[model samples]
Target chain A: MYVQRNRSLSIRSRRDPPANRHRFSISTFRGMQQPELSRKMGKMIKSENSAIGAYEAAGRERSSIAAQLSDWGESTDDDTVSDISDKLGVMLAEMGELEDVFAQNLEDYRGVLKQIRNMESSVQPSREQRQKVTDEISKLKYKDPTSARLETLEHELVRAEAQNLVAEAQLSNITRQKLKEAFDIHLAAVVERSEKQTIIARHARRLLTFIDDSPVVPGDARPAYDHETEARQVLEDAENDLRGWAPSVEPIPTSAGQESRVNGVEHDSDGLTTGLGSATGAGVSQPMTNGGPSAKKQLEEPQSQSQTEAEPIAY
Target chain B: MYVQRNRSLSIRSRRDPPANRHRFSISTFRGMQQPELSRKMGKMIKSENSAIGAYEAAGRERSSIAAQLSDWGESTDDDTVSDISDKLGVMLAEMGELEDVFAQNLEDYRGVLKQIRNMESSVQPSREQRQKVTDEISKLKYKDPTSARLETLEHELVRAEAQNLVAEAQLSNITRQKLKEAFDIHLAAVVERSEKQTIIARHARRLLTFIDDSPVVPGDARPAYDHETEARQVLEDAENDLRGWAPSVEPIPTSAGQESRVNGVEHDSDGLTTGLGSATGAGVSQPMTNGGPSAKKQLEEPQSQSQTEAEPIAY
Candidate 1:
């Protein structure tokens, strides 16, 4: 089958003259371009392949870590240090894998971008070629004398121009589609990889917490918290803030015909209010209109006083 | 104003005792019999709160790590030990927070389950009590004459039975609703947390990959591949399959007379073919009869093989 295909291709190539054979020559030129195109495509594919490989490797790393962690979870031993170390190692490995994939993807993106640039450069006409083509068309118009022949030539030119326009439009569309696909693929890969990182970070944080909460070896060289825990906490805090829960506050009362204001009076000159008398006497009656530092200070004074009084009661 | 509010609350408590008060007293009496129920609600609340806290903390940890890692990401420095250590520390801290929250939530869940059991025990009547009630009703029926007083007592009994039924149904409904709500909340939290974990894992993997690919310090530890990646890839592959991707053999040529045989062949292989291939080759002509594993495998094998070959050629 392969031999037959090659023979057919060779025969097809040699049967026609190079200049007169429009179909063969055009196709041959296209065929010749194929290898270069394939090479470029191959480079892109290779980069993508490597990126995917890195991605797979990273994924495997993460999965193994997950399995290990799960295994550790089921075990009865409290040798958290070893377990945590294993987890940390797994997390670190996973993180490294994620980074590898990310970097590879970036390289792939760059490769794609380079290919695009090359294609654009190759496709564009030089200034001299543009002028020559324009001049030739005009000269053809001047030389033609037979009205029918001129009309025919004009018709052919019009058709060619239309075809060229159509081809250009199609090419642009394809380019656009390819570009979009490339971008989308890159984005998807990045998102997927980033998401994995997030999981490792979370697990790592959990592991760290497990380690921290339990009593540590008296003179162990390990620090109080590991990198994973810190990273997890930071991410957690950011996420929490994003979800809107950094500070706790009582619901602001809203009532018709009553101006909403924070009540701030320091009758006791402390910062805390515990008993009903203090809460009602001045605190509830005096409403602070502003939320400036002075108001905050005033609020703090009463709270401090209240705290002093409350502390003794608590004791 | 606060004093007045307190006074009002006290008056209200005296007039129409707080539901919580009744609940508390009931809990105390039933504590020995149904200690679980008394603690369940509180435990559920506590668990929910802790889970939320853990989620928030994890988010924070991620953000902090992201910030720190961001710097490292841009740096071309080789000594990533310090950076790694720093990040590990953060992750550990975050993990600590997460574990604390998870532990709290787990405890709360246990408490809630205990409470549910307690409630179940409380709601059920002892066998002796049920017998006594049955006997009392029967006795009343026997003693009652065909008179106005007997009719009234019978009516009262009927009304009491109906009330009991309604109350029981309502209690069941309330319990069900509470359980559903608790489950939903817990499930949602679990899912959210799991997703976050996935994200962190993905990010961690990417980071790891990046580190692996990059020219970091020679002694710097390289991360390993884990199962998370495999699971994700498998999931993605399954999804793709669902979207539409499967292999099948071309059907055998059938003559007018052999149509019945063809139908039989289809019936036999119906179980082998999933929905994926059904949509694409719905009306295509077949060249073979029943497709066993070999035929199906033959058809399937080329796709992956061709894909592999085509990939390199494209690049």
Candidate 2:
């Protein structure tokens, strides 16, 4: 309800003009061109780029307004107004600088999101290859059950499945790890911006108090402003407070890639793992949650290494 | 220095491409058309409008990204990522809405600044009139010392000086009052936005902890996600914290027009004060700071009221 009251203060009754609602641009075309798997992330990243641009523009305009305020105050020729407005201008300019800094932090978060998008793009080809091999084998078998090429198609299917298995595992590993890492940077940035802006605004309010707004009568000159020293002191106090400010946010903890069983799973010369075929032949079934011990054992045994080397992926 | 390290994380080495630097629009033209006295405030107000627009655009983009994040998570077919990103989207959307509310608060502050600009516009004419009268009086006196029009010209000069005096006092009163009032709203809005966003981001980070990023080897699936309920609870907690949020800002105090000596000064039929001519004639001078008691005494006496009613200004 408090927020509702604030929103009601907008001079324009609408949120934005209807004509400006949809402006399809080059970025949307780029998002459409991305692989299906990475499309969503690509779009999100692009939208984030626009959001960062807005903040940068906002910061630039805010700093400009601060200078304008100081210039207007000097033109007034009232000593008190000039002194207080100039000091207030300094505080406002610092707030604009904070916006620029906040935008930079968001840029860091955006980079982490790009990693997720890149992983998504890399995983798409493996999925298509697996689907393609299965479809080909099914069509070939249905067309001729007596063909010698059936054996070759069957061999291709097995290799494709093995490669797909490795790809899926890598996908799962990277997706979860990068997702956590990205938001860790994002949420922390939010906290940092909030804390620093609050500090600047509180000190800026102190400058407003130095202004004496008691009205003067016509033909009666107001007393010469004696708060010049005090107004300057407020600016100094704001500077000191800003200099002493430090982040006070709780850090998010993560154990993303440490102690990874896949870290010990040996790969052949082509960076292809044969764990799927050999582990299945040995009937080395383990619960997904409790696979750590058996995986460690497999890491020690030399048999699993040779099996992976025998079935190098074709594509 | 600490902020410097964060800035280095930006993927783009440059701030923005040179092409996007300047874009001229109708607002700048409107600013240029304003009268000289109010031109600076006019431009500042226009710049603030653009800054508010930037924030609104940022908010819209942010909310879109939040939805995209949720959609991308669901497409991953990872239940853990789905639950967490959806809830994270909820928090991010709320942060976007905060930006909209902040822009509204800024519109209120911008309205207060307009009051000062309006007062400045109204005072400009009185300054020109006074200057014009003094110029004419000097020209006629120099051309003919004993001209018959000398008495009338001097009288007109006196009237112009009195009107300008009243206008100057009114300008001073309005300028200080509105400036203080405007920034009071502005700074408090900053504090409100900061405190609320911090609350949301802190709870959102808790959801990240629910994501299990431990890597899985090929041929071994990730364990079924067991933190669905915990992730859902994090969203509820964020909403509850936001609902309970309150403004935590120190109030800025102002005494703009209260105890105004000008408040008691009588105006003639045309709403013009004649205090200058008669206050001088009566030799009722007092220091501006100590004029309050004497002003109260003047209010009790009927003579000052009649004296103010004697001279009516032309324009």
Candidate 3:
């Protein structure tokens, strides 16, 4: 019976190996039968290799072209040609490096394919042995309370999934934060630069307007000077006159219940004469107090003169 | 000869009576022949008026819709329906307003057209008078040594043209400045708002992460505590823990070659350090003195352990 069992086991092993081993055997048989497939694979590999070689050849050709372009002895416009040639040379070098990387990637892919094949072969077991292993696994399952283990694993899986979700959310939040900060910083910089440009443009426009509106001729005494120079001098003089005016040196009144002195007398909101006393003490003359009547007469005289003279220019 | 000329002028005047006059004149006769054209123009105006009315009606409807959508009552629900309704209202309102503006523009165009027609008719001198004026102008052109008045007018024209060119250039510069300023203000406001929002979002995310990672069981925690509060507490705790252990303070050297005291630092560009020495003191305890080393070690150990444990959790 032992001899029969042993023979039966051997026969079973011969008939059906482990699943992975069967797969490997089947693949091996398929490979042997279909030489065309191997040939096609080999052709693909050769084409890939040739493509890499072609890339390298192209790189070399580009390098040669660059070298020829850079040959100052052969060309009179060396500076321009050499600059272009140098750029091309750098590009060619980069292309060569890219080709190398591509070749390496292809080799790595080939190795991974080989490893996958090996794994497939290694996973295959004899049919009888597989059956025995399945029976043993069933027996173990019956003896052990696998439901508890499965429940634990399921719980752990849920926890892990929740953790993963949290982590992903956090990562996304961080990325968004970084992007927002960068955008804000960029925007601020842009706004600042634009503001500076705007100010410069405004000043330039003011200068242009001043130049455009300036009088063509100065006073009769300085009529011999060029119009632009005279205008500029007039502007300079006006500016100097303005600068020469002294700021008030009088101390501000600190009297109790008195309104604060801002340049001159401060008026109440009601448009009344509440703050008139403060101005009297200061040396500064108040137009409202002394020149009120005469100023009004002067203003009317100008208006009458303007109205009379207006019609003469109309025709 | 004068009597003959007067008779001819009177005859011409009688033949070409103004349109406003009761009697028909040659010019008025020409205008009367274009009755069909006038009718067509009237019909066009009527159609335009109707179109404008329709546009105004549409505008009113859209404006009402927009007002309703933008009202405080509509913003209560943070749902898709409310959003869609608001968007639709805005679009309808915009469309209506655009229609109204279009109608107004058409009316304005019609008014301009009528004004142009009136100007043309008013400026159209009688044919005989126009000929006489042309003859006089030609005579003036043939006069020796052009009139001083004409010379002055020509100079004025040249000056006006130069002024126009300068004004145009100045206007363009001003426009550029205004555009730049507007853009800068807008960008600055946007940057400031965006930065605030980013900071808020970052804080929000950090709070969320803290809440999610807290060791306290959700069920065990106080049921009255809201998510926001819980998150805030977690953040506060984390901050306190960091403050207690982390040495983020840095020492800034004073200009007097004296050590400056700094405490309660938040973050430094380099690694954390302790306080600077006192101005007059020597052998002052710098960083890594007393509890510094132990605190750092304690902080580092837990962090490393947590990181190691987090690796598998991450995967």
By DockQ, the best candidate is 2
lDDT of 1 at A226: 42
Candidate 1's error at A74, in angstroms? 12
The recovered share of true contacts, given per candidate in order, is: 0.00, 0.84, 0.00
Q: B173-194 in candidate 1: lDDT tens per residue?
A: 2332223222223322333333
Interface RMSD of each: 30.8, 3.4, 35.4
Docking band of candidate 3: incorrect
Winning candidate number (TM-score): 2
What's the residue-level lDDT of A280 in candidate 2?
Answer: 27
TM-score of each: 0.24, 0.75, 0.18
lDDT of 3 by residue, A187-299 (tens): 23222322332222222222222111111110111123123444344434534543453422111111111111211223232221122233222222222222222322221
Tens digits of per-residue lDDT for model 3, B61-140: 43564455334113323232233333334433543344355445444544433332222222222222334544554566
TM-score of the second chain in each model? 0.36, 0.73, 0.25
Better of 1 and 2 by lDDT: 2
Compared with the true structure, what per-residue lDDT tens digits does model 2 show for residues A133-250? 7798788889987889877766666555555555566677777877887788888888887887888788888788777776666656788889877777777887787788776655
lDDT of 3: 0.30
DockQ of each: 0.01, 0.42, 0.01
* B-chain TM-score, candidate 1: 0.36
Better of 1 and 3 by TM-score: 1
